[model samples]
Target: MKFILGLGKILTIAFWGVVLFNQLLPQPVPFNLLINAVGVTVLGLHILEVLFFNASLRGRSHRWFDRLQILLTGIFHVMSIPRQPQLPRNG
Candidate 1:
């Protein structure tokens, strides 16, 4: 599952890079609208993941960077982040 997620992140980043490059071209490409629409859809999905499934970043000091990682790398990055284990309190 982790491997699959990582692969997904890689593909997503590559796709966004292509879309951005296409947008920078002087003349609009034939598939510009389709690529941009897919890019927006992917961005929305990542934002939703950050909002709902972001347990790995709950108590971090540098949350902004973590969130950016989530945006760039998807849920695989979130899964790779190590959470501090909580110790039980002794009364």
Candidate 2:
């Protein structure tokens, strides 16, 4: 499970990295849509992992806040999808 948790963290970082990179670099609409889809799916899986696997949060104080923070971060990443067209290929 630790490996799974670690993978989740890495994926979480990657989702945000793509978002910021896309912000800095121009990308196409379809690419943006694909990013959004993959990011949202990762976010959902992370949330499920935290909610179902992290038993510490179930009966502890501030549990809601911790989960909320994760949820909010996921939402932010999901909403930050890029909107510009990608650079065209040149011959």
Candidate 3:
């Protein structure tokens, strides 16, 4: 699982690299438009993930760094974070 998540992070970074690099091409290809659209869409989804998981990030160390990673890697970064164990309540 850890390896898979690491692989995912690498792939995500590579994808973003492609998206940014695609924008700099001298002669535009038809697929460039499609790539741009997909890149923007994925960025939106990553932002949504950060919003939805904001509560979980409270009190965590390096919270800002985690948020950045979440933006870059999306669910892959989220899955890699270890969950805090729940404390039992004395009812």
Top candidate when judged by TM-score against the true structure = 3
User: What are the TM-scores, per candidate, against the unseen true structure?
Assistant: 0.69, 0.45, 0.91
lDDT of 1 by residue, 17-56 (tens): 8878867872365478778887788889889878875676
Judged by lDDT against the true structure, how good is candidate 1? 0.78
Worst 10 residues of 3 by lDDT: 22-31
Off by over 4 Å in 1: 1-8, 26-30, 83-91
Instruction: Report clash pairs, candidate 2.
Output: 27-85, 27-86, 28-86
- TM-score, structure 3 vs. true: 0.91
Segments in model 3 whose C-alpha atoms lie over 4 Å from true places: none
Among the numbered candidates, top lDDT falls to 3
Flag the better candidate by TM-score, 1 or 3.
3
Error of 2 at 14 (Å): 3.0
Give per-residue CA lDDT, model 3, range 1-91, as digits (tens): 9999999999999999989888787227778888899899999999999999988998699899999999999999999999988899998
Scored against the true structure, residue 81 in model 3 reaches a CA lDDT of: 91
Model 2, runs deviating above 4 Å:
1-12, 23-26, 57-91
Window of ten residues with lowest summed lDDT in model 1: 25-34
The global C-alpha lDDT for each of the candidates, from Candidate 1 onward, is 0.78, 0.61, 0.93
